[model samples]
Target: MVAASAATCLVVTFVILTWALKDVPWRQIADGSLKPIVVLENANGTPLVRQGPYQGPYISYEQFPDTLINAVLSIEDRRFMDHIGVDPQGIVRALFRNIQAGSVVQGGSTITQQLIKLQYLDSDRTLKRKIQELVIAFWLEGKLGKEEILTRYLNSAYLGAGATGMSAAARIYFDKDVEDLNLPETALLAGLLRAPSQWNPIVNREGARQRTEVVLDAMVDNGKITHLQAGAAKSAFAKVNPTRPTPRSGSWFADWVAPQASEVSGSSPGSTTVRTTLVPRLQEIAEKTIADTLEKSGEAASVSQAALVAMTPEGAVVAMVGGRDYKASQFNRAVTAMRQPGSTFKLFVFYAALKAGLTLSDRVLDAPLDIKGWSPENSGGRYRGWVTLAEAFARSLNAASVALAQEVGLDNVIAAARELGIDAELTNTPSLALGTSEVNLLDLTAAYASVRLGKAPVEPWGIIDFKAADQPEAFRVGQQSPQPVDLSPYQSDLVDLLRLVVEKRTGRGADPGVFAAGKTGTSQNNRDAWFIGFTEPLVVGVWVGNDDDTPMKGVTGGAIPARIWRDFMRQALRNPGPDTMSDDSIAGKDNSPRSCNVSACSRAYRSFRPSDCTYQPYSGERRICER
Candidate 1:
């Protein structure tokens, strides 16, 4: 009688605990009432843009392809149809396998448990949470049909690359709907269930390919697909090319900052306002400079798109122009598109040489170089027999840069890039010295910012502070007080080298008649042109190129990109407002030609005729007008 009484009390306690844990709001998920509205603001608390919660069209179970459904079942839960909610046999099997392997190789959670975890519970792996998950899984199983459970799971799973549902993932990865997915495409999506970011096709193609193969093998093992079908799927998967559509937004900065703001707010029940680091006036100048430059020279140069990013030396991103026209294409070339940095990458090679005890006065040969059958030549096939390291850098001699990189070791060159927070994949080939490896503009610019600040890693940041719409106080973002890095022994020399490029070499077009430092880069055949430069207060990077990667007609980094950089810098430094300029004052006066007092000039040059002489605005000098 006492044992029966104890058992009754235990059952009552368990029931009460399960009841208390049931706090998920099913109605909110169904009605989309929980989506937060986000507002993005510039640095001075001016609203830049507002974003509403975006909901893609819902995909029903009937719309799902048979292969997709089978793949998910085969990889995520083999016995999903037969199990009620929790599978004791599968659990025992998983435990035995884990013990044998000495690690977690498989999971025993059913589809219902996964759904419950996604919608109702946190991801804690404690015993109490596990018990709650099991109990809730059974409750959810009794509440919904198998098809409904699977459909909800499909609609709520977080696939990487910013997709949150199968429908969105289908459009993001394949540019198709759920019902249109082929076997290999379906398998790829299924593979993401294991680890979305790790197997993301956009960022890690090889990882996605390997994970897809694993999913296909699982389907074959489960008798979902024949061996012939699996082989064909593998062949097709190898050839799949993902054309991800850019986010449809007016501003790339808005798109980039909105997600981060949402994450900061968590699941708080209100709208959010994020004050970002963008400078309104500077952003306007950057946009106009890129647009006007492209309008004037795009067709003539065969260049269709250009991007620019400007930041303070301390790493606050002040201005960003993602493209010439955001409406034409929303792709953010500054942050997303990775292209060969060309000679801009030589900065790393030279820094590594400095770390290896080489001096700017050291002589290096700029002759033709052949390393393991890969030869690099200078422009016009010209060879300066021996030049100082600084002179070679200013001239951007490809052969000399490669020779220096070889002496410093490729490993050290890669380490230098890492020290500056360049996370892009870099290979140890000889051409790496010439920047054959691809990198995005934002990271490359931030790496330069690190050098200017004498810091090891100057991470670029956007949002300054954020708060829920109804909150009384705002929470700050990013490091409030970042410590300075110990100056490298050769930091001053590196600055001098960059300044020489602007003042006396390829980047002369970038000189705004003041103290400035910059480098110019042009890839082979002039496919990409870049000018990255900095004043005392700001660092800016510019890229001019075709969207299709076609070579431009004689456009070099020193031409259009440098001109744009100089124009933008002149305007940004003109006013020097509190929000625009940093703590230190820009050293030199604006040497750009002042607009001539037209009346005074006309009085002085009495013989100047309207047809014979016209005011040249860009150069601020008069030239004879052509009829």
Candidate 2:
């Protein structure tokens, strides 16, 4: 009977062991691979820096310096390799110490055991937890060899303040690399494993040193270092310097870069360095020019807030500005502010006319006109009786424009604006011709740039890539592929007319000691004045207005704001060669000017146009002007 019972009991024990090992899956746990994050760098490859809560870049054991591994080995477990998975003598000693102390003061766990606890087990602090740890630790040892287990443990272990692993420990504690770590630095990292927050060298310097000394004592106890060596290391560690916070830079560059970051990160427009299309040097010149212009014009307080953005002819923003004082107001008026565009809005109306097949020479009566119930008057409040389509548009006659808007479809005008990326809900009414619909400055700038790029619209983006520091090698997924670049369905002639909008009509406001293109905008009652311009290499937008929207006497978009933009562009383009004023030969159809006759027209149109009988432009507009 005793022999049968013993045989049955042995079989049951073997079955139980198989069941426990079944769920552990030892083969797959060895390779703890992860990818590295990709951070955006500037043209010179300097990381586009941002300061915030630490976002850890996971690092691997291979990248870790030998000094770090040695320090940890020396301090925590010199016998790490010699032990199978646990240290029996240490556990027995801990139990005896706990009994003598009359409490569970210390529960001895090898580094390998602790790694199993941190990575895969629980921290219940009960007898059950101890047993659970034993099972997982046994499995870890069975699956990952001792070296693999140690490496993963060192790499994934949590340090402090959202940072994980030894790589972060190196950067956080010493602000240095693991390879560069000296003996003292190694000691510091090793001490942090016990309690990262408590032994943080930055917050508690003296305590950190003392705790590190305790690690040195452990090294002595383990015979990894002699007593004299421990004493000398402890003495030398006191001389290491503590980490300090990064410093702050003032104005200009901050004003330019911070807005880009705010737009990309979706954070409040405070100090940040977001990756922008703007070149750093180009942005500097733009700001310097604005400051000098303000100083020269003696309007620093008068025009306290201004914004600018430069873009490639292909529509990539190169340099950007939120305001003259980024520290004061974080509002990104360049990209965010919406106000009446005045004449800048006229390009859409003219384009709408062209799409309707209205030629530049087509005659349109510019007489005082009332639309439905609204009478649209010219800028100086006069009628331009009958003028050629070219003369009416070139001179910016309001009556003629409103008349033309009625000829072409209002929906087409809205569609044109939307084609250039303006999505604001514009009422398809006759008033749309009067520039009544408010639009965002950035959207308008981008729309105008569409005319320059001669391609499809593109949404503005600040960052190319964002990766946390120390992100693992395997985690680098980099930029997404098949970038959404659409450039079809847009008529090329539309961009050509847009270039002309800046050249003949808006040149006074857009010229910056170079051949550039842009438009000037003024809201009703002069509440807001805006100048949006671009050189071949730079796109500049400036807004001048009171925060209260109060009318400034005679603050037209062409005067002070234009002066600011011109000054800024002049400085911004000093290095880049002059913009080539290549004509985008308008195709599809010459629908520029509706019919207009200058015979006996009102003083407004007649004064803006010469008393001529016949005139013609490349876009096939007929007008009467002196040679």
The best candidate in terms of lDDT: 1
Q: In candidate 2, what are the lDDT values of residues 172-280, reduced to their tens digit?
A: 5556655677766777778888788887788888988997887778777766677898788888987887573231222333344444433222221111222333355
Q: What is the C-alpha RMSD of each candidate to the true structure, in Å?
A: 22.2, 16.1
Model 1 earns a TM-score of 0.58
Q: Residue 212 CA error for candidate 2 (Å)?
A: 5.7
- Relative to the true structure, how large is the alpha-carbon lDDT of every model? 0.79, 0.60
Note the clash tally of each candidate: 0, 27
TM-score of each: 0.58, 0.60
Worst lDDT run of 10 residues, candidate 1, spans 585-594
| Root mean square deviation (Cα) for candidate 1 | 22.2
Top model by TM-score, which number? 2
Model 1, position 273: C-alpha lDDT score? 63
Cα-lDDT of candidate 2: 0.60
**lDDT score, residue 447, model 2?**
72
